[model samples]
Each structure stands twice: as structure tokens, then as C-alpha cells.
Target: MFEEWSDRRTLRVFDPPRPVWVDMAATGMAGGFTPANTVPLRVRTSGARLEQRMQGWQHAWLQVSDGRWVAVVSVRLSSANEQSHASIPLTVAAGAIRPAESVTKDEP
Candidate 1:
């Protein structure tokens, strides 16, 4: 569901279901080129902006806003509106949920 790469796009960092090795350097490192490399790479866990998109021999990488590179599969491109909505907590009165009986199979 990722759109084309663009600067100033707010992105959220998330840990994948499985471990994904990420590169710490933005350039001159071939560690991200191969997932089976003996070199020990770090996992992604920081939220940052989209700096650049890099194509690796085996995978695609995204240069984070902080100059660190991470697997594209590890982060999700977030829109400014989504970021703003995420900050506002949902109150119980917001109707995020309802009584179990209120949700019927036919209605849903």
C-alpha cells in the first residue's frame, strides 16, 4: 500500500513479524545487499521521515530522516492527517465500541 517516495512524508517505524536486518550507514555498505550476510546488522525501530529510497540487489531500502537505512518492508508511509489523528485518543463516548448485542451478524 506504499505510494511513491516523496520528501516530507511522515513515516512510522514498526517491527516486522520476523527479524529484518537494517543498515546503519546511508552509503558504502553492502550489508543490506544480502540478507544472509555474515555481518551483523541492526533491526529497525525508530520513526523518522523519508530521506531516500535505495535499491539493493536482494531488497529495497529506505533511508530514514536520520540518515540511517532500513528495509522498506519495515516501515509504513504515514500521511500528515493520519499522524494528527493518531495523537488524539479515542474516548469511550466516541463509540469505538458498543454492547455485544448491538453488533449483530446481520447488521455487520
Candidate 2:
């Protein structure tokens, strides 16, 4: 789980098996845009993994699966009266274990 915030620039990253969330608030925009908005996009990983990248102003949500992993990376830019927040959720399996290897050496 990770959280980050900034007045002008902000970046955040989320790790799987944990809850990842972010929030932002902007006041007073130079441009005539009131109550700014954010755009969000997501990318899934191969075989039980999730990945996402965010830019500008955006937020995201991710679902977790059993024996799976998830990750999210995001960035934000804010102006007066325009704030953006982003969040991602990752779920993983609980009962999946990897097998261990045994090594043996023979000496004369």
C-alpha cells in the first residue's frame, strides 16, 4: 500500500496483496474550469498480475484474484480549483506455495 500527494506534482505506486489508494484536492484554477476531473487507465499483468500507469489527473481501482499479484503506478498534475485522486486494489491467493529444490553432492 502506498500514498502520495503534492500541490503541483504528485506520484504514487501501489503493491499487491494490499490496499492502494490516493486522494487529491485542488482549489482555484487559472483556467475557467471548475471542479476539475481526472482520467484513469489500467493495464493487467500476465498470469495473476496487474499493472497500471496514470498521468495528468486520474484514479483507478483493481480487483484481486486468488494466487495473483497486482501493482499500480500513477502520476498527477494539479492546478488551482482542479484536483485529482487515484486508487488501486490488488487481491492475491492465500494458499499457493512454490516447491523448493533439493541439492545433493557426491564425493569420492
TM, every model: 0.19, 0.17
Tens digits of lDDT, candidate 2, 1-108: 334333212222222222222221121111243232332222111112111311221122233434233223232322323333333222212221111122111110
lDDT of 1 by residue, 43-100 (tens): 2222222323311111234455676544432223333233411111111111112123
lDDT of 1 at 22: 24
Each model's lDDT comes to 0.28, 0.24
Question: lDDT of candidate 2?
Answer: 0.24
- Local distance difference test, candidate 1: 0.28
- State in Å the error of residue 107, model 2: 56
* Top candidate, metric lDDT: 1
- Worst ten-residue run, lDDT, model 2? 99-108
Give me the runs in candidate 1 sitting further than 4 Å from their true place: 7-59, 74-108
